[model samples]
Target: MSGKKEFGTTADGKQASLYTIRRGTCEADLTDFGASLVAFRTEDRDGRLTDVVLGYDDVRGYEEGDASMGGSVGRNANRIDGASFSLNGKTFCLDRNEGENNLHSGWNRYEKRIWKTEGVSADGTSITFSLYSPDGDQGFPGNLVISVTYSFPEEGALQLLWRAQADQDTVCNPTNHSYFNLNGQGSGTDICGHQVQIFAEQFIPVRKGGIPTGEQAEVEGTPFDFRAPKEIGADIERADEQLQLTGGYDHNYVLAEKQDRMRRAAVVFAPKTGLRMEVITDEPGLQFYTGNFLKKQKGKAGAVYDFRSGFAMETQYFPNAVNLPQFAQPVLRAGGAFESATVYRFSRVLP
Candidate 1:
């Protein structure tokens, strides 16, 4: 069954609520504000329930945190070079929030807004949240209607499906920005010891300011290689150029050029808790970030989240795809619709 509770009001006094769906041993907590994932709990190997996704106890923490936490990001997730892009012979300039580029759709990103509850499943297995964006919002040329659904039907899995349609041709790429700590949120430690494996052979290299340099570098000999399971901190501290550029593991790994089919993207193992999370998605790229810049911020249950405490695997189209012709284009036509799905499977590693 599912339950709903009053989350809180937004800065503009818009009312918000949290919907929770439970199936077997898994439970997902989602809020209408930003269509964010508030918490995801799974039974550990010790038979203890643990909330694995990092988040706050209320809506105020999300508004005050630097990281997006568990919110949905869109209007072109990630960065756009120089905060500008050309489409149909017209150059569109976006609001620059990160240096000379646009990061996660700038200051007025979708994560800062409140979404409406669109629908719920008859069996209480899913909840859909939606928002409408006017044409020229965030300097993008389209009136877009977006919906994101969170579904929990099995004991150890949660699926996120995103859909968007526009009245005018525009850039549209959306992904969830949920920081994960399989050991559980507010656990007072980082994911440095978690072993991670990403099924990618090449990655998009970024220069200073976190903009892609247009080169698909091989991960053969660099610290970007995670082809096999390895501790997150093993090569994270290496004196590599890319590692230093982003201050940690913050780069986009290019999946094989597959079309419209869900594929395995990544797997993360938290040794201490014996929790394993497998990511599957139909997107073309995955942005792996090690939360390198996180500081001692307040979180759920009076938890002080410090640097490198959690990590994120954002599955979506490549960053700055609007400016790169060679990359997967994120442009949506007037009559076309965008649809993508990603799933996170949680299971306990038995001793």
Candidate 2:
């Protein structure tokens, strides 16, 4: 099923619409502003419906909120060291938003822009949103055209397809920054009881500013280890230095498989609701953040979101990838296409 509603109007007087897509037992509300996934509802083991992705009640909350709630992040998804990188022997300095480093494309964030509607699918299973980033926009070289498509299939999967093309060599790494709480959006419960398992044996270690230190450290025996299923809070408060530095699990995990191959990256299950979500991506790294910094923010149904209330499984290239030669390069060349897909497959786990 498919439908549309008037979300709100932008400050520039542009109108935004909230589109809804539905499949077998799933429904998603998407907005043109930021091309954000405003809400996603699925059934649990008892066939009880729950909204898994977090967000507010209306467009204004998204416009004035913390910005990243269920939004598409780009032109580079994660951090870039020192807010600059050398591409083709030229230094491209980006706007720094997180300390001395640039996080999620800084001030000119895609999450704050109004994307154009690119039409829905013939079967109403997908809604495509498009945006254009001019050359030198946010200090990045090249004129870039980006399209993010959110699709809902009949088999209980919410898939995201990201495609981009540039006129010059530029950085293009986009990911859906959707924080999820399987129990329910605005459920007022922390994700500590959620069980998480990442299909990675190693992770890129971070420095003081959340920049990768160019080291793919082993996850064995460390709190970073998630090769096996365990409670998200099991090792979160450990005395481990990495945990101490970031305050929780906020680092990038190196996928066990090689890069650019669509594969399973991680799985999260909320025992309370019997909701299971499996993340499949073609990207090489997964930023598993546990909502460590979320403050008391208002949410739907009069719920206030606090720390650990949600978590994000962001799939993309490593943080500061352009500066670290060892990391997978994030450069999209002239006339070349940058294509990637990530799927959040949902299901129920019965007692």
Best by TM-score: 1
* Local accuracy of candidate 2 as per-residue lDDT tens digits, 235-338: 89989878878889999999843455789999999999999999999988899999998899898778889998899999989989889887788889999998
Per-residue error for 226 in candidate 1, Å, reads 0.7
Per candidate, the number of residue pairs that clash is 0, 0
Mark the regions of model 2 whose C-alpha exceeds 4 Å error after superposition.
256-258
Q: Model 1, stretches more than 4 Å misplaced?
A: none
What is the model-wide C-alpha lDDT for candidate 1? 0.90
Query: Candidate 2, residue 155: CA error in Å?
Result: 2.4
- How large an RMSD does model 1 have? 1.0
Pairs in steric clash, model 2: none
Quote the RMSD, in angstroms, for model 2.
Answer: 1.2
